[model samples]
Target: MVTIEPIMIKGHFFTAVTVCLPKTTLLTISNNTGYIMCGALDVGLLNSRLVDRKIIAGRAVGVKTIDELLMAPLESVTYEAEQHGIFSGMTGVEALLQMVG
Candidate 1:
């Protein structure tokens, strides 16, 4: 089963998605512009190598499971994100707010 719901944080609407599989649930939270604010601790996100010409802030969590990523502390971030004052060890929500600011 998959569920996607709208959540408001800091006056911004975000999409929260959860896909339940046989033994795992894939979860992610993103802003309206499709910038990933939080996601599972997957290699695709953790050690992402994709580089774009535009400087989009990206961040990853340090959870062992997908669900834990929801509240997990930030583990890594892109250089552009650093310029926005987003840093490792901060919560995902904190990073998002900083990015919006």
Candidate 2:
């Protein structure tokens, strides 16, 4: 697993990570607004992380290769995420909103 410190992107602060397995790779990104998971990572895995956090979390799809994960379009999102106007098919970078919380 490779992790990055929270960095500013599209006006939001996000911590990006990539996990490599024997046959697949997964990406996880999170910010004050929400979390986004790509590849085979399960959204349920984030429940514990969300218990004390007010941010939303969702899954991103449309990725045919690991390299495309960051730019891939969203496939499913949580209600809180939708409130930010992040919808299915929106790119990860485009879905992010400035942190206000």
Give the whole-model CA lDDT for all candidates, comma-separated.
Answer: 0.58, 0.62
Off by over 4 Å in 2: 41-55, 62-67, 98-101
Per-residue lDDT of candidate 2, residues 27-52 (tens digit):
77776556777846454544345534
Provide the global lDDT of candidate 1 against the true structure: 0.58
Model 2 gets an lDDT of 0.62
**Model 2 quality (TM-score):** 0.66
TM-scores of the models, in the order given:
0.66, 0.66
Least lDDT summed over 10 consecutive residues: which range in candidate 2? Answer: 45-54
Per-residue lDDT value at 58 in model 1: 45
lDDT per residue, candidate 1, 17-48, as tens digits?
76777855666667633344344433344335
